[model samples]
Target chain A: MLISSAQGAVRAADTLITANWLDYLLIAIYFAFVLGIGFMARRQVSDSIDFFLSGRSLPAWVTGLAFISANLGAVEIMGMSATGAQMGLPTVHYFWVGAIPAMLFLGVVMMPFYYGSKVRSVPEFMLRRFGPGAHLVNSLSFALAQLLIAGVNLYLLASIVHALLGWPMWTALIVAAVIVLSYITLGGLSAAIYNEVLQFFVIVASLLPLTLIGLHRVGGYGGLKDKITAAAANNDKITPAKDQLESWPGLPLSGFDSPLLSVIGIVFGLGFVLSFGYWTTNFVEVQRAMASNSISAARKTPIIGAFPKMFVPFIVILPGMVAAVLVNEIVQLKASGGEAAIPGGASGDVKYNDALLLLMRDVLPNGLLGLAIAGLLAAFMAGMAANISAFNTVFSYDLWQTYVQKDKPDHYYLGIGRLATFAATVVAIFTATIAGKFGNIMDYLQTLFGFFNAPLFATFILGMFWKRMTATAGWMGLVAGTLSAIAVWSAGEFGKAFELSGQGLAFVAASTAFVVDIVVSVVVSLMTAPKPEGSLKGLVYSETPKEDLIDPHEASLPFFQRTVPLALIALAMVLVLNVIF
Target chain B: MSHTPERYDAEDARDDVREDVADAGTDTGSGRHTAGAFDIRNIIGALLSIYGLILTLASFVGDQSLDKTGGVRANLWTGLALLAAGLAFMAWAKAKPIVVPDHIPHDDDRPAGH
Candidate 1:
């Protein structure tokens, strides 16, 4: 599997797990298991409720794991690990600051609105609170985003398999989609969640070995730091002062790397506004919580998820650190005798996305390699299945039922949901196959995330806490905030083109959009007529009693109850990890 | 001039009563009401069993070569055990397909929905 170019520097074509009998065997069994879950769950899906929300019958444990698993996307794993390698340990802040606290906020505060509202989807909530304009805009944006996300995910999965297995792009895309489609169509959301939990375990079990072995070989965590630092420091192509290998910035921004991006940007832009926006408002993630059988269970969902979510960086990020050393060594060796380095391949520079694979190639033997690869494949499929489930639910409830055909039979909507799933899968697969034509779509979509999410969060904050927020205000605020975000982004791009210091434009876009949304919403709410107190009964905080929002049973429990305690534990672990690194 | 306002509480109450009555009368065939929409055991078991079976099958038919499995039968052994475990789950589900009694406790006490 060695790929030697004309320059004679050998690059490993097979990323890892030299593809033997047991590897294929493990993978095949996993596929069969995924299908079995789907088929077995089919009969239980008697109505659209079953298809979408598992009839809201799932327990906290089931919902929690699935909740985390959905966000623990396979596509993002490579990106996270890559960030780990490039930006150093500050990347973990993306989880600790950006995710953990936000998840808790959603669980403790926001779930009351989502689960208590009895709304089938996020857009439905918007329709109730704001109006049709906000509802339509959000539903359309999310629906389109899911499809593009699914398509890109499929393409990403296909490309990886093509590179590793030498299978055609279509083979990988079709096989993965078919496996995902089989169970989703058969069992619906329950099957999807069950499989997601299964994928989470499979991926964790497979990759933990990579981290353990990598650390063992490098002596320990301290050893790894020393080795990687030395290698990075000596590499002639890029002069890396020892500080470059550091987790905390020793200069200026002592808590985080100032040169990379500020702690303010990370904490405020990402942690507060953007994180809350995505975690709370986006139904894709909240769908897991919304499936819990009781309000109590629903509230526990995200907190339960946070425990495992905090620990993920150990497996994903550590491998990147290990690769940093291996990469430095490879670069030094390639350049030692004036020999040609293969640029982005094995002998030249570390491919951040391929950090995990590069680690496998460097150390693991046959059996473990195969398992790790299988785990990765499972994770990718899990993410795809999650998106598909969310997409189908949102499409059917928000778009199809409300607009197209009203008050149809239960089975009629169920049928439509299944059809939507199939259609979405096909569209994604096709998009993956033709992904090369519109390769830059991924970058555009990333920028568009802030535009859609940041402004939306501002509206939600006003709508939830402020009783004076009129429906008209909701619509206007959303429109104005979104436009401001777009304008900010355009200005950033324009500045970048003109060679201006467009540093941290992403953060700038988000913070500015959020501020504008808040100001506009407040002013508009004050100017416009507010909804009468009686009409706003269950929706607004002023009208809804304290009991409905906070469960009596949960409230009566000790401070050491599962909700706050789990969050504290997660925060503790993140702090420990940050300090040790 | 005077104005009047109306709320949907009474109508919602009526819908609740009708929904309850319909649920009670849902035993369409002959005798009993089974699991309501969600069959947790069957669903979980099915996933577990399938997962188990695949592992077992892979163990038997999987390839062996250098830079691969090193002829380890952990995959096969693990799969067979999982398959058996899965079947056991299915058997448990069949034995106890949750009856879901007609009058669920505290049913009238909670809010109907958002």
Candidate 2:
């Protein structure tokens, strides 16, 4: 009997996810709602603006949920949980220390410039501040980045479907792509945003139960802590229990031995450069804010998102921690230094990425298991749709409309946007194959962000505030910054120049890019002539009047509704959370 | 600023057409107060309600799997919570419907001059 029970454990790994009919029904219902929202939203798209920006008419709550949901893609869910399983408590820094402050800064300081200027996309904002050179560079790079990232999301989504239903990989990929493509093509940004809002709730619903059930199984947080401590003592390969339990310094997460250097890397590199660069400027996130009905709503969007954003670690990261302690497969894989096969994992290898799936298989029953599967689908689709929608907008407005075909009618551009969406979806299917080639897609994703966003953020912060920054400086700064980042990344990737590896390398690369861009912009501005003060009126912060930057009506609202007060409250809450954890 | 009046007149015309459609009963007017023709809340509420119903029914009829979750009836509880949340969203939508204005001007409708 004992021998047979042991043999059963070995067999259980091969068939990890076994969903009954009830689970499939839940997933079918979810897909129906997703596609239905798309068809409904299609009716509202009368022009390019509606197709691209939802006609800037959505309220704060909808756009706010969409803002965070667009970001809560497959990477955010699976990747963060994987990180939680690997690095433990230090992963919380990605949210509290890294995201919240920058998000608040975007709301209080940056949203006024972005929304007040009324740019269709982030690249368009670059065009207004810089010129054709910078705009072209920004547009092409952004479009390429979206396609690559969309591929990553698409690949993960298809892999989940393949794992869940035992479908062939090719069939899974095509079926997943068509679902997202159909909705995005039908509804445009409105469809994407509505689905995103729905996705957010679905994600929370699915993960929250997993976390609770896992915690309950492990004898709560206290029991998990004891198990982690015991595991750390037994396994010398993993991070120390103390480092795993605490959020400070994050030595293991940073890949640095020295505590001081690790803190600086976490605070400046990840928190300031990468975090601010991403939350403030990424068009995928910024487009949600731009779809708001009013300037005040736009400003409140990110700030509202920040509220839910801070607490997400509980559902996402906690489950990972629980899995690390509770799941026999993960424990064995971790001890084996991830050399073992993860049984039913899509990758065929025991990777940290399989932590969430393993945990769900161990804990959830059939009915709830189906809900969790649907949640993951919603996350990946929301992520891919965001990339595709943002890609189509930038392609139509920033690239094709601006350069390829000028002076087009509104409906003509709208048609181009839909075509671009189709082209991007098809391109993304191919890109997903490219993404599959990489061993760790997260490292690749971080490297891509470092290449595109870091330098762009540097140029934006400089040009927005410094009235004397020239158009020549704008493009030059971006080029030099990107090259410097690439150089730093390659040095770390291939050579032994930097002591860092993994995410630490990406952070260093981003910081180098930011500093290089600033230096280049300053030097170029000093040499070349600046744009005239008249042309810089609304683009430059100093030249734009205070009233024009904000909604005067927002002052009459209650403190909770006001942007500044709400941001401050959020800021205070995050700081308290930092102290407690 | 220059395109403000023209944009408003265009929106007013669209509003008139929408009102006529609403009177004809072809349009359900789910978003009569909202910007679009459909309320996102209703979609969310409807989806959650369906999922909640399935889970709730399954909790009674399907395998309990109480041993897997350490003796907890997770489906029953989570289904009830979802049902409550779904009903709350529906109620909130009914209580405070968003008012869509006739026109909301764009920041700049024209192409950026090179």
Candidate 3:
């Protein structure tokens, strides 16, 4: 195939890969490894909590690894890379400012209530306090969120395979989905958690080496710095610049005035909304927290989870920036009538995905490439496994028995959970196949997931704070929030009534739903005969503690004393970096 | 009136049973309290339920530019207060000291036998 005309930057990558066998071997090996792990863990899978929630036996560290691993899907690696390719360093704020704080708060604050309440799923908690309606809304919202999220994860996995091995996108997606589903189906959450831990390590090993080498290849660290500095020197960098510039400090467009309100809106809306939503509502990761053996263990899990998240940006994002500098230079070379070889269209979505591929093919040499490929594969497996396991668990517990066979046997329910896992995987495969056709599938999937997330998280949070939030009001608020998000998206996509904003819209919709739900639920709860706060003990843990509950400071006193100071120290480091850089 | 040794032994047995059930690997006894000791799903869920609580407060604070604008000290303080409260709720799952319900219907009473 003829290289694209504007193939200035990818010329180096274009010439290097004459050997197809190596790519196939790499992918096959990657597949075998992940499936093998799943098979091995399958033995440990029990029918009840062990299979569903890892027997709640995982200590802090393993739980921590599984937690981080589960979060590491193709969405983050590719999405953040695309962001980094455009945005630069300020995007790191997504972790330091947004995720870390949330995780820390979740660890120190949220763990006790959940641990004490002894609920299985977050929605199950809602049902005990509110009613069946609350549980239904929560479970449905979660299922929807996981549904789209699974497709997106598969799509990213497929893109990498397609780019590396020249497999058809759909072919790659099917293969990826089947491999992931086979093991995930076999092992359930136990295998998923165990495999996730392994995948986390593999991804780190794969990316870190490539990142270091890539930096070195681009004229060492010093040379690399000069290249990006030159790129930034171009004032025209604004339009085609990476997606994250709005958050970069001292970058001409940091917040509100940036070309799009997306960044500012995310900062204002999503920083809080998504953090709380994912932390509280998303059961996939929180299930790991729930599976912790002790209250103290659960409390420490989020904190431990936060530390890796702090570093992940550097591992994934920095290399993309390096690749951007390299790719842009190639474009400049081609502009001069040089035989510049680019693999795909430069500056488009395809090239954005290909940029990382190009970097890997070009920079990673022998055994190292195998390792790096393994990392990508690890990311692929871990991400997919997390989604599949969570979906299966929710489907089995929340949907299958709850709706289909309310009085099924334990063995029967376990069988159903396994069946649900298979069904969920099938749905994902079909969805990813359809989603694959869309060029900017990653971006679209995230926004759509955000739409589903905005309302449910908002209602659940409000129900806790406001005593008056009745079940009827929660249902109303959930409907309102989801509809509000849909209305925003619909107006932007279908009606063209208003310009479609990005992350900001999700935030606004989520916020509006939360506010409205509280208002309506409170009014209705109070106006209609109020239910006496009966059996609301373990259900709602507002500001006051039950008598036996130890003060958190006293309960995990030793850990808290050290962690608080340590967190402050890290905060200081970030502040210092801001000042210096 | 309730000082029987058998009663104390029975209470101990029940505690052991509860702990055993908590770790009941796949044993979903009819009355099994899946809600474990460290279950923060609700608290986290609740805080998360109120989406953007902190962000909303942060916006108002930033809008007033209280640090920069010199708004009424109370507005500044209130913003600070809301921020702290929001952070506290989001951070400490046990921030809301939930009193374990006084009346947990016995699993024996429930139709499902644990």
iRMSD per prediction, in order: 10.4, 5.5, 20.3
Instruction: Identify the runs in model 1 with alpha carbons over 4 angstroms from their true place.
Output: A1-17, A235-261, A327-350, A430-446, A494-503, A555-562, B1-114
DockQ of each: 0.06, 0.30, 0.02
* Residues A116-204, model 2: lDDT tens digits: 88788999999989989999999999999999999999988887876676665677789889999899889899899999999999999
Q: After superposition, how far is residue A319 of candidate 1 from its true place, in Å?
A: 0.9
Docking class of 3: incorrect
What local lDDT does model 1 show for residue A42?
72
- lDDT (10s digit) by residue, model 3, range A297-401: 666677777768778887887877777767654334223322345535322233454556666665654334544665676686678778778877777777766
Candidate 3, after superposition: displacement of residue A535 in Å? 1.6
Residue-by-residue lDDT tens digits, candidate 3, B1-114 = 111121111122234334443443443344322322122222223322222233234335423322211222222232244345435644443332212222233323212411
> What is residue A356's positional error in candidate 2, in angstroms?
0.7
- Cα error of candidate 2 at position B75, Å: 0.4
What clash pairs does model 2 have? none
On a 0 to 100 scale, what is the lDDT of residue A349 in model 1?
A: 38
For residues A1-581, could you state the per-residue lDDT of candidate 1 as single tens digits?
Answer: 23424222222353323666656766776677777778666755665777898767676767898998886664457656655554456556667766888888888778888888778888888888887877888888788777767776676676567556755556778977887888899988978888878777667756665677677667778887787566556566432435435544322111233644565666777678777877888787899888776677788899888888888888887777666665554334323521334344321233455666767766655444566777777777777888889999989988988789877777888888999999999988976655434423323444556778888888887788888898888877777877887888787687552222212455667778889988988898889888776766557777787777766666665665556676677677767866866
- Where model 3 places Cα greater than 4 Å from the true spot, the runs are A1-33, A220-222, A232-264, A328-349, A494-504, A543-557, A560-581, B1-114
Model 2, A336: alpha-carbon shift in Å? Answer: 2.2
